[model samples]
Target: MRRAAIVGTGAIAAAHAESLRALGDRVELVAVADVDGERAAAFAKEWGVPRAHPGLAELLRAERLDLVHVCTPPRHHVPIALDCLAADVHVLVEKPPALSLSEVDLLVEAERASAGRVATVFQHRFGPAAIRLRRMAAEGVLGRSLVAKCDTLWYRGDAYFEVPWRGTWDSEGGGPTMGHGIHQFDLLLSILGPWSEIRALAARQARAVQTEDVSMALVTFADGTVASVVNSLLSPRETSELRFDFERATVEVEHLYGYTDAHWAITPAPGHDDVAASWREKPSGVVSGHRWQLAAVLDALDSGEPPPVTLADTRITMEFIAALYASAFTGTVVKAGDIGPDDPFYKSMEGAGAPWADAR
Candidate 1:
């Protein structure tokens, strides 16, 4: 069995523990660590873990762990993941894996230096519906992909930002674009492939935070497909939705947080009844969450291969976020290659402060 540990004791960490438990004999929850000693011990006891430590360094020294889930906030992801990789422990980090492209590059370097690999948690891609959609698209069942819409409009009150790191670029990255909508967009990228450019606008419409409460972008994929993407924490009626319009049909998934096969639907275009039937015939069973992704990660480790949501795969999503910020700040279209070494956005999502800084 693969011995695993969780690095945070927050709600998300508990979810990770639950999923690890659901994996049965494939993985063992050996330890849990939190900065708060009491919280760590309590979490360990609550989750039936064998050990608890106040910090990862102590846990690393004590346990022979095969994997460590970095469930800490966005700022700590890179450092924690790097530490785990250096100790030859595979790492599965939460969303918005690193604050910037450069930080992600550092983790990539560490992964190259170590025997173990690093994977970002993009569980949305693991759902059976997502898998089937990708397969159908590859097999030409979707025909020529055209326009698409991706929305992650969820509500977050000002109280949510009372946590010191919640809204700052130094910690949470960049509001809804990085924290909320990323899951849906990552799934979109997984299906549609690399994005070429983005034109975007960001605003602090409803919340008083360092980052924008909402952002919208027009993304152009390398294959000539265009998508309208929106990330918002101001919406009253929350929903996570992705719709792809193809030559043969319109395929969509509507849900909040994780999704199963039932959340997905396909509407065939005129004379495309066969495509709709085929979509229904595709495999079903898996639901996207920590459990499914963890299974894949453990299997990859067992087979001595890089896991799903690999650094390369993660870079695509990170680049898109960078481009979105860059476009919003500069009021110009940003391309995939635009935010490289010399780009200000490469190091910070604020890009020399947001364009609306003066207004705010």
Candidate 2:
């Protein structure tokens, strides 16, 4: 069995543990680590792990680990990933991969520097519903894709922001865009391909966070497709969904319970009367993305191949995120292919914890 170490004993760590445990004969959970040593120990005990460490380096240097699942908050991503890659250990980091494109580039350099792997955890792609959606779209079920509407409306109270880094830009990155809705945004882009431009508006409409709790953007894709993505942390009941409309067909899926499946619905528009027929097709999948994502990672490791979510794909998302910040700040449409290394916001994480009302 391939040995693995899970860094970060946060709430989300349980899901990762549960998923990894399910892969019984394939992977062995070697250790659990968190900044709070007690929390790490408790998590290890709860999951029946053999060891626990107070920090990532301690775990890495001590354990004979082949992989590290990074479940830490956004700010620690780059640092932890650098440490892991430097040690030549594979990594699967949680979403909203890093703070900046520059940070992502650094990780990419490390991955190249090592004989190991580094993949951002974008588990949504593994969801059966998502898998079918991508399959059908690529098979031409969606004739000429035109528009996509991706929405993430979930609520988080003050208690949710109790963590010091929860609502800050410097640590958690942007609010909903980078935090809660990042997976959904990444899924949408993964299905629709890359964007060419984005016009955006963001604000702290509902929460007292350092970034926009709600935001919307108009995006134009490289394939001449137009899309709109909206993210918010204000809904009473958490709902995450995506809709894609095409000239011949349309595909959509909704999850009432976060990225993991509570349910899914994918419709293939009919030949003549499309929308009507679409309503007739049934949806499938009722499992969380956690399991499939973990499985894919193990399989890739065994096969000596890269994980599905590539760093370049992640960089694409970050590049677009930079565009959103620019457009939101300057009140102008930001072109995607236009952002370059020379841009002022390129490495502008200095004072990053400031108001997210404007990043430009």
Candidate 3:
């Protein structure tokens, strides 16, 4: 069994710890680390972890871990991942893997030289229904994807941003686009493929924060499919939704956080009534979460291959976020590969600051 550890004792860390326990047959939860010593100790005790350290350095020196989950906040993802890379330990980092496209590129460069691989936690892509959707798309059962809509409308009040790191560009990245909506849209991108261009707008609608509480964009895929996107932190009756219109069927899913196959529905187009039966044939009851993804990660490692949500695919999602910010701030249509080394958005999602920075 591979030895593993977690580097943060936050709310999200519990999910990672539980996921590790669920995959106990293949890995051992050896240790845990957090800046808060007492909290780390408490977490270790609660989770039955053997060791607890005050920081990553201590945990690294104390245990010969094979895999490390970087469950810390966004700002610390890169540095900790870099440390893991230096130690040749594979990493399964949380979402918003790094704060910027440049930071992701840095990981890309470090990953090239390290013995271990870096995979982002995008568990939604591993759900049984999602796998079925990808297979159906590949088999042309859904036909050519024509248009889509992705919306992550969730509510967060001022108290939510009181955590100090919740809203800032440097700390949490670019608001809901980088945080809340990324999971839904990343799954969308996984199913639809590479996005070619985007034009977007952002605003600080309700939440009193440095970043936009609401963002909307029109994205065009390389395959000529078009999608309307929205990420918001100011909705009352909130939901996470995606709708894809293909030549043969319209596939849609609606859920709040995690989803099972039941949340998905497919409406067959004329002369394609068989699509409904095909959808029903897929497996069900698997909810999207860390457990599903952790299993895949271990399987990949066992096979001597890189894990799911590889850094290359991660770059696509990160670049898309950067492009959205670049377009929102500069009011320009940003094409794929436009945020190169020289671009401001490549260095940071703020990209010269949002238009309403001073006003907020």
Model 3 misplaced regions, further than 4 Å: none
lDDT of model 1, residue 260: 82
lDDT of the candidates, in the order given: 0.91, 0.78, 0.94
Q: Would you give me the overall lDDT of model 3?
A: 0.94
Clashes of each: 0, 0, 0
| By lDDT: ranked, best first | 3, 1, 2
Give one digit per residue, the lDDT tens place, for model 1 in 1-360. Answer: 999999989879977998999996999999999998898888888889888998999999999999999998889999999899899988999998999999989988898899878999999998989988899898888898999999998998878889898988999888999999999999999999889999999988878788999999999999899999999998999999999999999999999998888889899999999999988985565678989998889889888889988999999899899999999988999988889989999998898899667765
Give the C-alpha miss distance for residue 277 in model 1, angstroms: 0.7
Best by TM-score: 3
RMSD of 1: 1.1
